[model samples]
Target: MAQDPPAQDLMHYESMAQDALRGVVKAALKKAAAPEGLPGAHHFYITFKTEAPGVSGPDDLLSKYPDEMTIVLQHRYWDLAPGETFFSVTLHFGGQPKRLSVPYSAVTRFYDPSVQFLLQFEAPAGEAAASAAEAAAPSPPPAAPSAGEGEAKIVSLDQFRKK
Candidate 1:
């Protein structure tokens, strides 16, 4: 039997995993929204691309974050409305409150350190194929319960290679 030629421009599974992972974040937010507040101590650290499309926020914030910014969802955040395409929230910054609306597609990382959980995705590439792949499959297996709900899978890419 002969081995096949290496797959051409293989799709990155991590992106698919991110799609699945974003669902987890959306679910958590939904649960939080359902009861009028987040349960217990659950909160999120959302990191996103400031330059991505469909992202809107204060000009100062955009300037400060430049390419990427991380926001904490605790204590002073308000109006946390999660939607199918994006989420809108208000948080106090520099003693002033500001509102931000970011698409899920704009987000690059989400983490709940209380559970040691994280989900990371690649930045959008200005290419049709990559975009197609992303649109086709997004998300990953939900955070494992035993590993602590919502925890990012700490994977070593080298491990998957043939020895």
Candidate 2:
């Protein structure tokens, strides 16, 4: 017989915690990106996927780092704008200014060395991330990999919807 209804969901709790932590990062970025600016020794080191969804940056600079890149937001940056889902800033490289826009979801680590605080996140997965991973990986010919080749069938929810 089935036991009493399960009471606690550990994964749900963990997801909530993760969201709250992400919010903290957003808040910190907002503060540091503000006009008042970094408020006395506060700076950020944000590391994120270069190929992840919603991440846009100078092609030359991004190509130098194929997978991940870390940016320090301390000085010599401009137009630091933090949006609801992403942030953009202008930074100097090789004596030239370059701009980058990164989605918060793509960020893997956020740190403040001055305060010795750190937050880390798992690699985010999405259409772009999945596509990027697929492009980077080698695959057999399309004809060689068929659904009947031990692959699970993909269900289309559209089949259940009214036309």
Candidate 3:
């Protein structure tokens, strides 16, 4: 007897959920940009793919964090502009200021340690496969860390996945 094909996510619920969550990020940033600024000790740690499409930063910064990088947005940041699909901000690195533009789709993780809130996003299907393949290749030399680079709290999604 022939077996049926495995189930597929034709409804694209995952994409929808991710988009909605990104909206949450945008809204929070918008609120932070307000005159009052972030309220009650709220801060953010945004980790994103450096090489993802629509991401822009200094060449040195990109080379240092070729794959992924985390930025802390607590203090000493300015021009926190949020757009329809991307957000731009100016941050200091090594005593020099640099600007970065990151697309919401490029964000892999968002965390607010003050509130213990976290959101982890999976790479789109195609990119996930490509990233897995890239992982098999040899990596370049490790680069020095920039300012405000801190240890990231890792959370696995295996627990939420269906076996």
Candidate 1: lDDT of 72?
68
TM-score, model 3 to reference: 0.79
lDDT of 1 by residue, 1-163 (tens): 9999988756877667777777887887777666567767776778777788888988975786555667767556778899987898887665567888988878777776667677776675553365567569865422211222332222222222246
Candidate models: Cα lDDT each = 0.68, 0.72, 0.77
lDDT of 2 at 60: 90
Across 1-163, the per-residue lDDT of candidate 2 in tens digits comes to: 9899888896787667766788888898889787788877877778778888888988997886666777777766789898888889887665567889998888877877678777877677564566467769866422211123222221222222246
Q: What is the lDDT of candidate 3?
A: 0.77
Error of 3 at 13 (Å): 0.9
TM-score of 1: 0.69
lDDT of 3 by residue, 23-90 (tens): 99899889878888789889888878888899998998678676777787776678999898999988
Ranked candidates (lDDT, high to low): 3, 2, 1
* Backbone clashes counted, model 1: 13
Best by lDDT: 3
Stretches of candidate 2 off by over 4 Å are: 1-12, 126-163
Estimate candidate 2's alpha-carbon lDDT, on a 0 to 1 scale. 0.72
Which candidate number maximizes TM-score? 3
